[model samples]
Target: MGQKTALGSLLKRIGNSNQGKVVPGWGATPVMAFVGAMLIIFLLIMLNIYNQSVLLQGFSVDWNGV
Candidate 1:
């Protein structure tokens, strides 16, 4: 079909154009460090909240109320 031929030619042109391109962006190291720092902060906050909850609730369970 004509549509199929047009689509194939469009794809071929795009492939040829992008054959040796770098597509630049940030390298991995700094982005990874940022993500790692955020994860540590999140874990610390969660641990603090869990400790507070344990202190207030004293490990008691009321399963039947569920």
Candidate 2:
């Protein structure tokens, strides 16, 4: 019925509108956190590889003494 459709539309509009906030954005927090965590993880992995490579090379260089 027309009344049913109108009521459903009104409910949808009310749910979708964010009543006014100081900052406007629906999904900035989780997205930013995900990106930041990924960046930190990538940097940590790179650092670990660099450290392991250096330690291996150092040991190889001193193999004759050991």
Candidate 3:
């Protein structure tokens, strides 16, 4: 119940704030852009690795081996 009340107050405070304020030391836009760029890079690298694995060396399963 206490946790619920605290969460409700926090939500109400956030709702009341129309003027956006970024946390000190780091602006939101730059952090978001950096995170987005990193995500894209990671996805590209994963795709390349997957392509190499599937296209260059095919996967096969032998029932006898299993």
Q: What is the TM-score of each candidate against the true structure?
A: 0.41, 0.42, 0.45
Ranking the candidates on lDDT from highest down gives: 1, 2, 3
The whole-model lDDT of each prediction reads: 0.74, 0.73, 0.72
- In model 3, the runs with Cα more than 4 Å from the true position are 1-14, 17-26, 53-66
Greater-lDDT candidate between 1 and 3: 1
Cα RMSD of all models vs. native, in order, equals: 5.9, 9.8, 7.2
Better of 1 and 2 by TM-score: 2
lDDT of 1 by residue, 1-66 (tens): 345688888989988986877767765878899999999999987776656643545543446655
Q: Model 2: what TM-score?
A: 0.42
List the candidates ranked by TM-score, beginning with the highest.
Answer: 3, 2, 1
How many clashes show up per model? 0, 0, 0
Badly placed stretches (over 4 Å) of model 1 are 1-26, 53-66
Encode model 3's per-residue lDDT on 1-66: one tens digit a residue: 345588888988889786676567765888899999999999987776656643544543435655
Model 1's alpha-carbon lDDT is 0.74
Over the stretch 12-56, how does candidate 2's per-residue lDDT look in tens digits?
Answer: 899978766567566588998999999999998777765675354
Task: Locate the minimum summed-lDDT window of 10 residues in model 2.
Answer: 54-63
